[model samples]
Target: MTIRVADELLMFLPAARRGPVSRVPSDGTSTLGHLVESLGVPLPEAGPMTLGGEPADPSTRPDPGAEVRVASVPRPQPVPLEPGQVAPRFVLDVHLGTLARRMRLLGLDTAYHNDMDDPALVVQANEERRVLLTQDRGLLRRRALWFGAYVRGSRPDDQLRDVLDRFAPVLRPWTRCTACNGELVPVDKQEIERDLEAGTRRSYDVYGRCADCGQVYWRGAHGGHLEKIVHEATRQVEAAGVAK
Candidate 1:
């Protein structure tokens, strides 16, 4: 049998097959879904398929000499989230601490606790309906997980870009606490006055606090730095064509 992949979905195809449609040895009876996974693309990542130019589901077995075409998941994907997750919320395993922090910087609802075990992470994902974001393919292979993605990049920047490209979560800057996965709300100066140092009290009037942790925040000297990152992340997500 022969295989062809859409340009956007090519990355999921095997390396040599990634550049163009290529011929493949086929089992006379295996389902198209099995063939897709055998070639390295996960079932969830696989989209519509066609055999011999006719519409087909991933479950359909191809006929002999059938030229199959595979497409990527349709964007904006259907991912679960917490009630207010304008973009999908996330649950990261221990390895993604840096990425989690970076996501929180963009005001995304990302849950990352270094102490969580694999079982706990899976349970949390199911209970909270948050997408599991991990580099481990084994975890992504779990059938109980309703939503997830395999992070292919080793660097934090590339990981972030991959996430932005794949999920297209809406950017909500300064709306979440980077220290904790908590929502941020404006707090009047006098309300959190007891928590502030004299320098903080005198230097900044605008204040915000984490609804869950009660951690205080203000637009202090680092505001510009935070703004810069927010702008950069927003630009990247936009360039990825997923920003709403």
Candidate 2:
């Protein structure tokens, strides 16, 4: 029997059970929903499935020659940011190396390890309730991840913008170590003189210390450049208004 399946729904079956709609076997029967999922699309992304213009669960089996339709779910809107609240934390997979650095520079709570395996990334994200950011589609598809994003661009600046637009976190510039996402603490200039270059010591009197790794920071020649980058990245988000 020839199955006249709807164009909207994609079908999949075990290799032995698979056949073209024009060649659908009389013995083969499966729900429009199951058929769509068998093609690799997640259920969450699939909207209502229908047969003959009536609502049909993916589990509802259809006879051969039945018409099936699968609709897609609408994309979700970005959640509003909470103001006067701590920023949402993130865990980036190994592929987002530059983005992790940029996020840390902007003082977002971000965790990154260049050598993190995919399984470890899933575990960390689930345990910490951290948003998982990755370039891998498989990682985003993990069931344990409540929040995740598939980075759309390869450029660091564009990736930064994509993250900001997706999750508008409260920006607190200069509050984290760009190299290690550690909290920054104010330190006395005289206390860390040996760590400073001669020219840096001669020019700057103020500094901040990283609480976790004891890294020292100062407003050196790079400060202005960093500040500008942070400012530009966060300006639009601030203008959009975060929740208080």
Candidate 3:
């Protein structure tokens, strides 16, 4: 079978296989998604596919001589949801702690643990019905995972952008605990005065505390930097006409 890939996906292919089209001796048994993964492009990073010029799903099996075309996942790609969810929630791998915090800052429900093993992570993803976010292609290839996506870029900021651009989840900034993925609720300053340092107590009046973790938040010196991230993401989603 001949597989044609779009230009955006060229970077994931091996140098010898890097071309507009690749001829693969198909097994005629494996699904198109598996074939694409075998070619080094993770399934989540891939976009829509066409088989013989007809739209096809990843599970479609191709004949040995059929032509297949693949494209990169488009910006503002809708997040896949499980039952009972209004929006996509995420479970991030250990290495993505910073990205997790950033996502939580945007009030996205992000679950993360620094020491969770692959098996554990998969279990959490399945159990919680969260979209697994990871930099590991191997992890993304796991069959048992309910849903997942490959996180592009190295730096946390760039990775955040990649995710935001790929799946424009509704943003509710400052409504979640960056430290613990808990819902943030308004807390009277008097109720948490003992937890704050003297300077913090004097400088900030409005506050929100995590309902689950009890961590407090206020607009402090770093607020501007965080606000910039929020504004940029909001603008991008608005520009793409994604729902708030």
Per TM-score, the best of the predicted structures is 3
Highest lDDT: give the candidate number: 3
**Candidate 2 vs 3: which has more lDDT:** 3
Clash-forming residue pairs, model 1: none
- lDDT by residue (12-101, candidate 2, tens digit) is 224554443434333356655445545544443456667777887766777776666556442222432347546778899998888998
List residue ranges in candidate 2 displaced over 4 A: 1-85, 242-244
Give the Cα lDDT of each candidate. Answer: 0.81, 0.71, 0.89
lDDT of 3 by residue, 134-193 (tens): 988889888898788888899998999888877878789999999989999999999989
TM-score rank, highest first?
Answer: 3, 1, 2
Candidate 2: which pairs clash? 3-65, 33-58, 83-243
Query: How high is each candidate's TM-score?
Result: 0.80, 0.70, 0.91
Model 1: weakest 10-residue lDDT segment is 76-85
Residue 228 error for model 1, in Å?
1.2
Each prediction's RMSD over C-alphas, in Å, is 3.2, 6.7, 2.1
